[model samples]
Target: MSRSVSSHTSPVVRVDDLRVVFPTMDGDVHAVNGLSFEVPAGGALGIVGESGSGKSVTSLALMGLHRGSRARISGAIEVAGQNV
Candidate 1:
């Protein structure tokens, strides 16, 4: 069953001013830059961009799959009102 989103309920996922930079021998590669959005309860998300436009990188950042790597992550990422 589908339910309407509650105005009073907090977002299920929130990403604010997120940035992901991968340091390389040559130079730094910006995977995701200044990306911010929120998906409320019972809400949905869609990311559309060209190839190499940080789509996959953003998803990885949300899941914290970039950890243990040389990637530098900043800003605030929250899921269910808890930091990710």
Candidate 2:
């Protein structure tokens, strides 16, 4: 589960300042804010949070599977060393 930072060929995924916002009847829900992390090639990473913590949304974002097109996402998201 551990990997040498310099040994990995490239980051399997890279998220920087990643944010996701949703507009609702009340206003806006900040699902994610300034989230940042990297999973290097052949490496393991874990995300832990309470319900509605944006955990699934963040992973889906990495897979390019966010539900709404209206969702506002800022910052950078890279997968397999490529921007998405």
Q: lDDT by residue for model 1 over 1-84, one digit each (tens)?
A: 868888888999999999999999999998888999999988999999999999999999999999999999999999999999
**Which number leads on TM-score?**
1
Residue 2's C-alpha lDDT in candidate 1?
69
Model 2: lDDT to the true structure: 0.84
lDDT of 2 by residue, 1-84 (tens): 754566537778889999998878899888999999888876789899999888998887777777567677888998887899
> In lDDT terms, how accurate is model 1?
0.94
Candidate 2 residue pairs that clash = none
Best by lDDT: 1
In model 2, where is the ten-residue run with the lowest total lDDT?
1-10
The CA lDDT of each predicted structure is 0.94, 0.84
Runs of candidate 1 exceeding 4 Å displacement: 1-3
Cα misplacement distance, residue 12 of candidate 1 (Å):
0.3
